[model samples]
Target: MTTNPYDDIAEWYDDRVRSAWGHPGDESDLLAMLTGLTGDVDGLDICDLGCGQGIVSRRFARMGARVVGVDISSRLLAIAAREESANPLGVEYVNDDAQSLSRLSGGSFDGVVCTWSMADIEDLDSCYRSVERILRPGGWFVFLITHPCFQGPGSRWVGAERVVVDYFAEGFWRSENPDGVRGKVGAHHRTLSTYLNGLVEAGLSLERLVEPCGIAPINASLPDTSKVPVFLAVRSRKT
Candidate 1:
């Protein structure tokens, strides 16, 4: 079996995520955008793809959805399962890669959500295909990712302005700054078009797009991020 890159840093990453959630003033808009896109998931069967530590999955379960959180990292899933056991939200955590989702049944979900995890996935096309396969007819797929244009390889914040280099450079890249998540796990960089086109190819139609402006709590190193959009959220429907 292939070793999960997140297994070693699972505990550290969970702590960082929890700390970020505690700071109300530094909250990220991705979750808000997700809520707006997926209004009232009450009693809906929702899948939280690439769910780490059950953060977003718990929210969905609390909203009355039968949530199944899938992730590749066993360590992260352990944390998620432990939290579920303590809180009893009825969330089921499954250890599976987003690219395949071999454990999940096809057309079994009312909606699928991937928040801030698309970049971490290596095979964008395969992941999108899995998302499409898992959703019921007309089921929505909502996702939020770092703005690829401004957050790609060699991109950084200089003073109050954002500097972007190699925007067209696609593939795996890691940030030099060790404090950031990208610096730790690295990410697959793809153009905005690549994401949209890939979705279309996977039989998911783009329904809505949101470029939210706010400084993500995790992006402390990128100052003045509010001046520009830091995250891109999209709502797509299976066709």
Candidate 2:
């Protein structure tokens, strides 16, 4: 079996996500934006694509959605399963690749959400296709990703502003900053057009898009990001 890149850092990543819950910024903003775009998911069958440790999955379950959390990392899924066993929210965690959720039945989901995990997926096109396949007609697909234009490789904060060294360099790349998440797991960078085009090609219709602004705990070396939009959230429907 191929080694999952997130397996080794599962604990570290879980801790980071847990810590973010206490901070009233990026994490909170992300969840708010997600739920807002999804509207009410009561009794809806929802899939949490690339669900790391049941963070968003639990939230969906709490909101009355039957949730399935899928990811490639067994270590992360273990933690998520452990949490489910402990709390028993009826969330099912599946160890599977986001690009090809072979175990999930087609047209089985009323909604699908991918949060902060799109960059981790290697093939955006395949992932979007999988999402469209799993979603029932008129089902919604919502996602949050670091702004492709401002958060790609070689981009960083200079004083109060963000600097992008290159926007057209699209591919897999690792951040030089050892302390950041990208430096550890790396990320596949895609242009905004590539992302939108992939969704359109997958038979998904764009509905709403938002560039959200929030303050999150950052490395001391970085400046305030509240004034700048760091993440982009999109809501689409399967046509």
Model 1 lDDT tens row, 119-189:
98989999999999999999999998988988999998888888999999999999988977899999999
Q: Per-candidate RMSD vs. true structure?
A: 2.2, 2.4
Show pairs that collide, candidate 1: none
- Residue 31 displacement (Å), model 1: 1.7
Over all chains combined, what TM-score does candidate 1 have?
0.94
Residue-wise C-alpha lDDT for candidate 2, range 113-189, written one tens digit per residue: 98989999988899999999999999999998888988888998887888898789999988888866899989999
Lowest lDDT sum, 10 consecutive residues, model 1, at 21-30
What is the lDDT for 179 in model 1?
Answer: 76
TM-scores for every predicted model? 0.94, 0.94
Off by over 4 Å in 2: 23-27, 215-222
